[model samples]
Target: MAKAGNGNWFARHKVITAVAATVLFFGVIGAVSDGEPDTGDEAASADQDWQPDAENDDQSDEAEPAVAEEPTPEETEEPSDRDKTPKSPEPDVEREYLVVHIVDGDTLELGNGETVRLVGIDTPEVGECGFEESASRLRELVGGQAVTLGESDEDRDQYDRLLRYVDIGAMDAGYRLIRDGLATARYDSRDGYGRHPREDAYIAADRRSADITCAPPPEPKNFADTGGGGNCDPSYSPCVPLYPPDLDCADTGPVTVHGSDPHGLDADGDGQACGGD
Candidate 1:
């Protein structure tokens, strides 16, 4: 009976050991599966965080480019020197007239056979103090040259000559004559004739010329007593000697007299000493 009881006790002890070993194996397997899932989750989180950083770096490199500004209106519209120059006076009507003849310092004959009296000034008459000089200067200014005519208040004078202002290039012929002391500024207050835009300036020039003194011509003498042939005699009735063959108004027919015309040849006191009647 004692041997049988001992065998039974040994079998029971072996069964208990086998059950403990089974429980330990299952616990180890469960632990390994849970650790593997945790490792995978950590790796996925790290990858997500690193992707957002790379995307931020790319976005910073693609920042917008800078733009330029435009200019203002004031900088583009500055005035120039050409804008400061004074403009020439406008005329009512401008006509181009050809100068066929220079009558005197203040008269001209047109190609159309019309006589033009230069308004605003009168030069010395033939045989007068500045007559020859004035006539010579006028020829130099407009003889055989084209001139521009500006009409005044009066179309014609009592002498039947067209009254107009003569422009030679950029200069006014009347003003030039007065400025040079070759002519005197004269205005007809009755008809308002000879008045001009530059009247005041012309009067000033005339005053300046008149201030200078000129020698008086000699007394009249008889041409018959001087043998009718001598130097110019200011005292004579004609104021010129006949013997010296001097150029009078008749002698210089239709010709320009640049030098002294000793005889009072220009009967009409025209600037021309000798011209067509």
Candidate 2:
């Protein structure tokens, strides 16, 4: 007879216990080998995903776009407007003005009773130096002509005159004024004014302008007594003899033309009757 203790129990169930333990060990091993690790923490920590994206590592990357960010209006906004070629200047004059009268070298009175002052130019006033010559030359250039007007940044000046550039056919009247020394370049980029289109050309012409050459004033009335035989025009020393005819320096040889040369003896316009500056 055996001892009726734990030994009896062990011997009776040995095959069953061995089978159960073996099944438990293999099931755990299979689950661990086939089922993957927890990837959430790893994916969160890493720059790249554990499973790479089909198109790009980043959805924002343009390299291989698949399900990427949609393009914006700014994408269309830039290329068309900013990248286009620059434009050329267009013709400005739309209609023409018929010049009826010349107010001065730089001013005009049109047939419609509008007055326009030449933009970017200044000439002598009525009683100032070169006034007669400036006025005369303007008449010769554009009087009674139909001229096209080009506007500046400003349309009118302080005197309520239209500020414009006058053009006859292809000839620029303002440029002619500056080139001939009848007018000087003004109201341009220089001297605190807006610059006009032809400012540079006018300045260049002004540099090459002829020196202003006109006449000197005539003599004092009592500079010398007219007590010779006849009454004398006191514009000169030794009585020029009042003009029955307009005289020239050709008539009088080097007379002292002081106050006013009524006979027009001072061809050179120097202080002496017929001399140079």
TM-scores for every predicted model: 0.44, 0.48
Candidate 1 Cα RMSD after full superposition onto the native fold (Å)? 17.2
Q: Give the distance in Å from residue 39's predicted Cα in candidate 1 to where it truly belongs.
A: 66
Candidate achieving the largest TM-score: 2
lDDT of each: 0.71, 0.79
Q: Which digits, one per residue and each the tens of the lDDT, describe model 2 over residues 1-277?
A: 4577677778768977988889999999989977877687676778453556754456546665567677897766565775687888888647888999988888889998889989888999987889888888989989999889887889988888888889888888889888988889888888888878888998999999985777777643431344444656767765666766666654554567777778776766776765422
Q: How many clashes in each structure?
A: 9, 7
Q: What local lDDT does model 2 show for residue 196?
A: 83
Model 1 TM-score, all chains together: 0.44
Clashes of 1: 9
Model 1 Cα lDDT, one tens digit per residue, 1-277: 8999999988987998899888888999998887776777799888877767677878876885656667788668776889988899888466678998887889989998999998888887877788778888888888888899877767888899998888876888888888888888887543465456667777878787643235796543433234334454443333345336554444333433333445555555554544433
Off by over 4 Å in 1: 1-93, 188-195, 210-277
